[model samples]
Structure formats: C-alpha cells, structure tokens
Target: MRLATVADMPRIGTLMRVSGAELFPRFYTERQAASAAIYLTEPDITLIKDGTYFVYEAGGEIVACGGWSKRNKLYTGSGSQQDDGRLLDPATEPARVRAMFVRADWTRRGLAKAILDACVKAAREEGFRSLSLMATLPGVPLYHAFGFQETRQTMVPLPDGVQLEGVEMTYELSQ
Candidate 1:
C-alpha cells in the first residue's frame, strides 16, 4: 500500500465505483445501491492531501483504497456539515476511518484489512487511541471481523434523496 496522491484519483475512483456497484446491491435496493455508488464513493481529497489515504496496487492497477482522518469529517460527500473540517484532538476524539473501497474482483482478498491495519498503525503513531467509521451494510461484516463494535445504526442522506443505511462502529487501539 502507498499513500494516495492526486495523480491516483482516477484509478481510485474506478475502484470505488466498481466496488460499490457490485457490493451494495447485495444488501440494498437497486436505487439505493446506485445512489450509494454515486455519492458515498467520492474520493476525499483531504485524506489524500493529509497523507492518510492509501491505495493498494497489483500489476499497475489500484485494487483497493481507504484512509483514516484526524479531521472531523466522519465520511465524505455529505455537503459540508457545521463541524466537518475541524481537526480533532487526538486525546479526546477518535480518528475517522473514511472512504474505504476495493475493486469488485478483489473482495475477500484481505485488502481492506491491510488498509485498516495501516490506518490503525498510523493513527496510533499520531496518538489516537481509537478509530471510528460509518460502515455501509455490505461492509459491516468486515468491520466486525476487524474488531469494530457497532455503536448505532445510521441513515446517510444521499444527493439523490435516498437514505443509505450504515452502521456506526468504533475500534480501540491496543497500547
């Protein structure tokens, strides 16, 4: 895995789109799935800029992408909430795990876990004791296997007026 650069956005976008298109429909309506693939899969430039986002490649193609953020944006494509861009205090707030996606053919290949491992290590290096993410229904099993506990159910409003169901989950880093 390597830190994602602006130059990598196109491939990353492709990965996200294919991943969401193939994965979300298993657990959501066709419209909701399509809306999710459209809205939720947007690349978070801030993660790339902050040097937190990462992509895994095989044969010159990006196969997976994900990141952790010290900023307050829990997820992306939400159209700027009040506290969206603020930096979080590592002492008091969990680092945000944002924008995780994998190529459709790359599922069950440990890619997301590899990214999550990197995120955990990176966040620990920066003094964050925990990490949090809003996991799409299709992603909940993976997050659960990674030791994240569900805190609540979430309904994210997409740009197309569709509400996507997700789970709020948190993971505590071992000291």
Candidate 2:
C-alpha cells in the first residue's frame, strides 16, 4: 500500500465504481446500488490532498483504497450532508474513516483490514481517541469484524434523490 497521489484518482475511481456496483446490489436494490455507484464512489480529493488516502496495488493496478480523515467529512454524497470540511478536535471529535473500497474480485483478501489498521495507527498517533465511519451495507460486516460498534442507521442522501442505507459506527482506539 502507498499514499495515493492525484494521478491515482482515475484508477481509484474505477475500483470504487466496480466495487460499489458489484457489491451494493447484494444488499440493496438495483436502483439504489446504481445510485451509490455514482455518488458514493466519488473521490474526496481532500484525502489525497491531506496525505491520508492509501491504495493497494497488485500487478500495477489499484485493488483497494481507504483512509482516515482529520477533517469533518464523515462520508461522501451530496453537499447538503454533514461534511463541513473543518478540522476535528482529536480530544473531542472522532476521526473519520472515509471512502473504503475494495475491488469486486478482491473481497475477503484482508485489504480493507490492512487499510483500517493503517488508519487506526495514524489516527492514534494524531491523538484521536476514537474513529467513526458511515458504512454502507456491504461494509458493515467488515467494520463489525474490525471492532467498530454500530451507533445508528443513517440515510445517505444522493444527488439523484436516492437515499442509501448506511450504518454509523464507532471504534474506540483505546480498546
């Protein structure tokens, strides 16, 4: 895994598109999956800009991508959501686990785990006591297995008027 550069956006976009389209349908309706594929996969360049985003590559292709954010963006979607782009107070606010995606054929391969491990380590180093994420249905099991407890059910409002179901989960870094 490596820090993702702006040049990696094209490949990252492809991985997210294929991953969301292929995996979301297993837990969501086709239309909902389609909408998620379009909106949820949109890369938040802030991650790359902040030097937090990481990508896993195999044979020169990016197979997975994810990162943590010190900023206030919880997840990606329409701008009307809670993403304010303000920096978080590590003592008070939980760092965000943002935009995790694995390629369609890359499931169960420990890629997300490695990325999450990196995120946890980085956030802890930054004095963050907890981590939070808005996890899509396909990601709940993974986060659950990784020790993220479900806090609530969230609705991700997309630009196309589709609201995708998501889970708000938090992990205590001290644990």
Cα RMSD for candidates in order: 1.1, 1.3
Query: Tens digit of lDDT per residue, candidate 2, span 104-170?
Result: 7888999999999999999999999999999999999999999999999978788899988989999
TM-score, one value per model: 0.96, 0.96
Candidate 1 residues 28-92, lDDT tens each? 99999988988888888889999999999999999999999999998876777888889999999
Worst lDDT run of 10 residues, candidate 1, spans: 76-85
State, as a TM-score between 0 and 1, how close model 2 is to the true structure: 0.96
| Model 2 misplacement above 4 A | 78-83
Predict model 1's lDDT versus the native.
Answer: 0.91
